[model samples]
Target: MTDEASAPGKSTAPGKSTAPQASDQYVQSLARGLSVIRAFDAANPVMTLSEVAARTDLTRATARRFLHTLVELGYVRTDGKSFVLTAKVLQLGYSYLSALSLPQLAQPHLEDLSLALGESTSAAVLDGTDIFYVARVATRRIMTIGITVGTRFPAYATSMGRVLLAGLPQPRLEEYLAAAELHAITPRTVATRGELLAVLDKVRAQGWCLLDQELEVGLMSIAAPVWNHNAGDVVAAVNVSLQAQSVAAQADPAAYLESVRRHVVETARAISQDVSAKHGDA
Candidate 1:
């Protein structure tokens, strides 16, 4: 029942952000209520009132009131001693997914690509420093964490994220580099901003990205940008995920790279074409 926030892959705890100036139109209470919802994530899906208070930096009394209010609104549900989000929470994300035709159009293409490559495939859009999965088709599980519609991952550590990041303008890209936390998620992760920028340059020029075990220890992925023909901009990215061990069995691993890239790029282009046609821009 709780609504997801604008920033994906992040649990916004109270005191972690500066309070906006109170005004006639600005509602501090609503912001606080949302923060309480944002505090729940894949890692902490259920929590007690005290845990919610600590996570959000709100007083226990304030947290209790928000939880009760959310319960009354059918966003939060209580199970004896703990609180958890309900299916109604998906409505918040569904609104965005419904408004944009990308996810719906990409679904069939993603399924075909996954079957063709014999791997999992997905499409996502950039949301702040994160990329949120909008459509996905899995042939097999490759990551420890489960990914589904509405799942989010850091853009810096993902192939799809890099494709989206590469689409950013110069000023926006620089701003992102300056403000983003470049923490290493895996040993193969690009550790420095300079290295990431260098990689992004290649992505910008090549119009594709092949990430080898960067986001996780054994996962490899290739992604290509989904262009908006009407707007002349990158709107989203599509990717195919592979397991390193499975790829190692290939007769020519080096040659396999080009094959994967071609498949991903073609799939992305097909989706872009669909998007353009649907908007009467083609």
Candidate 2:
């Protein structure tokens, strides 16, 4: 909802245009309406009309019209003074999820991984500058936030993001580096383009990524890229997350971490194989 990597008031739409808003294809009203929807997030789940206007940088009159329209559409509801999103809003995302096979394919694999490792496992895809979770199997609650199917985190500070970024083609990766606004999510976050590039280089060479305390204080994660049918490109990534204390409590921390990394990589490979097989049949 409130991604630290995103700049204030900037839309995180994938492939956002740098051209002027006056472009023929650019719909101002549509953009404004989406902005109104995005204004409600984890921090601000319910807001007044003026609060929505302030958050979206739209005038009260414009925000009101959109809010009323959303209410008429059953995506939003207002109890006279405040507005909140309804369950119907989830249908918008459900359409995308239902059409995507990756989540359905990866769900069982993630469940097995979580059961085996006694930790949380998740699969996610690159969305704009964020890693959007598509599937998750949680053994226990680790992070401060609840990680659901649609949770998003900045790509630069996450293991899954690193693996997905490493799988990107050179030109696309370069474009991302140029447009990405790097900021410190934590003290260990790779907040500079040059440093991030170096890390991605290693991830590309190693075929996986292990990140510690970059996204959160006590969380550690290892991730591997899920390849397409041809094994030519990464379609998604799978990861295992555990508390930092769990690794430290091990008699051999390095070996413990290495074991966890192996499991994550193996699970990713298994999922990739399934994807390839499914595609081959199709």
Candidate 3:
């Protein structure tokens, strides 16, 4: 994406190249390759040669070359009818998970939380405006949206995003606010920078955030920051997302979220203990 499309909320200032972009300068093949992978997602998983061209906005020939290159790299595959992804793509996400101490330790907690809360639970980190789900436990809900382990979401609207952003340094947080698009996804979406900032403050002060249909209709989530020994710096975030319909039908939203947040904190604490034990940090 042009630095203009540089993920969503985060800005790369003009003439101050924080992220590499192509122009009269130079095109980085590595960046382009990753962008190609990002372009192929749950929605656009299978694309024809022409569809890939339109989706990536690359010329048909350019798209074909990259597609073939990805095929050679074993990251993408074709079924003759259309192009699709392969399990080998998991290596990219697993590379990070394998190196991380938290995800490996907290995975069981996530599963337990999902079972207890009757909702999907995820551990994520802020990546630009998006939070990248590292470890997730899928749950069965009538309105459950299937977000795989490597899903990304807009921070300005997601429970995890706001919780994680609340942990960012002031300057970085300002940078994010200055560039956020704040697109409207639902009637309760926080599209203005002021609202986002206020919510971030409340998230920091309250130590958790409740996102009620901000990212999508019929979806509600509660997120809390995951910290290490310090309890100040947030290393990651954990969230429980449940169907909004279930919230109104079953239990009180505030009490439900409070219970879920407590479980998330306990899980994080347990994971931190495991990490410290493994790494001799204990």
What local distance difference test score does each model get?
0.81, 0.81, 0.70
Residue-level lDDT for 97 in candidate 3: 81
**Worst-scoring 10-residue span by lDDT in model 3:** 1-10
- Cand. 1 TM to true fold: 0.89
| Reference-based TM-score of each model | 0.89, 0.89, 0.84
True-structure RMSD, every candidate: 4.2, 3.6, 5.5
Best by TM-score: 2
The candidates, ranked best first by TM-score, are 2, 1, 3
Collision count of model 3:
0
Off by over 4 Å in 2: 1-22
> For residues 1-282, could you state the per-residue lDDT of candidate 1 as single tens digits?
011111222323322444556889998788889888877766578899989999888899999999999999999999858999888888877878899999999999998998888878899999766788898887766676667787777788889989999999999888777656777766778968999999999999999998887777777889999998887889999998887877898999888878988999999999999998888753
Q: Which candidate do you rate higher for TM-score, 1 or 2?
A: 2
Angstrom error at residue 261, model 2 = 0.6
For residue 234, model 1's alpha carbon misses the true position, in angstroms, by 0.3
How many clashes show up per model? 3, 0, 0
The residue pairs in collision within model 2 are none
What's model 3's overall lDDT? 0.70
Give the better candidate number (1 or 3) by TM-score.
Answer: 1
